[model samples]
Target: MTPISQLSPRLLWQFFDTLCSIPHPSGHEAALRQWIADWAVERGLDVMQDAVGNLIIRKAASAGMEKRKGVILQAHMDMVPQANADTDHNFTTDPIQPYIDGDWVRARGTTLGADNGIGLSACMAVLADDKVQHGPLEVLLTIDEESGMTGAFGLAPGLLQGDILLNTDSEQDGDVYMGCAGGVDANITLPYEAEPVPAGHQALRLTITGLRGGHSGINIHQGRASANKLLAELLMDISQHAELRLSELDGGTLRNAIAREASALLTLPADAMDTLSALLERRQQQYRCEFAGIDDFIRLELAPATMPARVMSTSLQQRLSDALLACPHGVMEMSRSMDGVVQSSTNLGVIGTRPEHIHVQCLIRSLNDEGRNRVAEMTAAVFRLAGARCNFDGAYPGWQPDPDSAVMQLLLDTHKELFDVLPEVKVIHAGLECGLFKAVYPGWDMVSFGPTIQGAHSPDERVHIEAVSRFWQLLVRVLKQIPER
Candidate 1:
């Protein structure tokens, strides 16, 4: 896979390359959706779009497999748009530039979109390649999966005729997932009043960066440092040692991703402004030691910045600082049944200082409704106690595990036959559309698996090359070995 264009599974790479050349970030997948719809029609397959822009394509079963169970190939069409701070790229207009890096395919200073793009490409390949044996097939491509799960939530009942759904949006290759976490978004707001900066005060820009921020749900238990949480803690500490007044505060981009960097603009007494250098230096050293092998390059620094006209009132600044510091930002609980698996967690993903009120965003993930709600309640209480209003939205149900699943057993046996090693079955912590699909297709049996992907929802995102070959091989065989109805 030195050059992704020349990779094995020729048809899959062909469609993936086309996807790379199209800009299809969350909520902006019209161009890609239309192109895919036309491609399906040109191939003489039945294609249609649902009310919320989900693209569905149906292909007849092979001659001998017509009596087998109908299988649905599912993947989200939209991708999380995240780029490096200095990278000059636009998710809405610019094509993703992917190149082979050793055994992986990575994008240039941006997320590679392999989270579901590769999965979607596989669906197209299965439709075009007649040799890939399958039963009655239906491909479901959902939109806005990254920012929100609008597409999955809006998917209507009785639209699909499939009895078994094979979700291809999972990241790791060696793991077959049967259940996944559900999630809710915590939107927070705190009203504040602006006041004139005190006399003889200077502004400084404090930055926390160089942390490896991974996907909030998948990597929540990895002990990675959150830049937003770090910044909030530092601000609270500085207030105790000096007269700190906040002018602007902001960090992170998407709620589904852990914060990689955060910055604060504040005014301190000019005479005491020199105090931040040593403080930042001390904190940086401590943080590095604390996160030693994890966030290897975590950093904290302060620089002189232009003076601001006004700052948040003393009371508001204190409240915001306290609230941010008190908010939850890591794994809250671990699964007792599964060793080392995260059961519930939260990411303090974003913060912004608007004109009138400060906005804060969080994402909570859990394997059950009670688990997620319990964490959400704890988080909401922290913000509410600090005089902020919080509301939970985008609540989706978790996928339940089925021990007696015939489709799952068939997939497992097929994988073992192909690789001589059984894939690890898991109930993952990440939120996938299969959970929401349960609401619409209550009787459909679902299982999710995909090629190995690393650092998803972040600029360091990349997909394994050899693993893709194995993933494709397994999919091809599984389709051929589908159990008869």
Candidate 2:
């Protein structure tokens, strides 16, 4: 038995343990999908796979419950792959090692994969538990939800017969998400010339790490520092005083995650090394003070390195640095309709420099299409000024809230009856698969809720133990209370 199996809510945790044993990172979910299919087949449940790798498992209504409305339980199968810089774990081959930390479950120096894993486990438990009373059920397990909404985007119309969708992709416990933000990815490439390294210059690698990088859309309001932007600012400032030539620069991983670490290799005048070190120290202190409470663990280091054969041209380096420094990040606008809800935001998610060109990726999100487009255009304009080509792709629509949604009311009433408090109903700033499903099934009443997950999309991700139990009780009760069709 696994450590997770010993946790409370044995069925859900047992399924979660099994899931953690199979490597299911974004864009690589073949094995996990097969496992889920086999699990359903062994139990004699009807299963179907769509063209995009989405799995739909069906279970007949319980005795005396055939007249109740059918419910579709939805969760994404893939998880964002993130690990500490020094961790040697590989997302493709290594199984996530989830361990209990007090009242939470976390992975060592890597993401715990609990954002949707716990939710997926809950659905699996429902399917396997014969005692759980419910009407006809369809479990929709999607793929590639972390990196792209490929599964949701390709869902065919009329594939599901349920009138209500219960999305289990939400992170918070005491909230029922009625809607979510839409998002688009902006890819920018800047062509640059390489020049021979000048004589009498020393090479140094400047590294910025330990920042609390998090989900771009969900945590954008927390004021966490972006390593890419900070490195650009530092490079621009250093170039003003010293003759610096950039050789290589890279940071970040996923386009939807805020950059946590960045490093730049450059050659600078040998005589100015001391002054450059002093400047970096001062700037680090300044940033620490500015981001005191939110990302106080920020660190900047400088180390001597061997010289490179070629470096970026002075003009191109300056242009790239300036454009990155000018790029917009964090929350840009707040919604007037929903109090304290972020309306529009952008994350300077990644930066990479190669011999021929430099690449910069940004993720823009908004509650409305207009806000999303506005930010994408603004980001493009900034890079275009620096002779970079910018293009937006992988765009998805937002889920519009239905005030009269039957599913939402049912979930709310179930929560109040189970926990003695009403679960907050609000729109999320982050993208959820429910939006894409709505495009395929426009009339399906939808609501999203799940166990409490913190530090998602980062190495620090974890799930609350007690919250899972409460979440399970609420889900089971909601299933038992569905109105007759």
User: Which prediction has the highest TM-score against the true structure?
Assistant: 2
Query: What TM-score do all the candidates reach, one by one?
Result: 0.98, 0.99
Clashes by residue pair, model 2: none
Candidate 1 per-residue C-alpha lDDT over 169-188 given as tens digits, one digit per residue, 9 for 90 to 100? 99898899999999999999
| lDDT per residue as tens, model 2, 189-276 | 9996889999998899999999989989889998889999899899988988888889999999989899999999999888998889
User: What ranges in model 1 sit over 4 Å off?
Assistant: none
- How many clashing residue pairs, candidate 1? 0
- Cα lDDT computed for each candidate against the true fold: 0.91, 0.92
Candidate 2 CA-lDDT value: 0.92
> Residue 318's C-alpha lDDT in candidate 1?
83
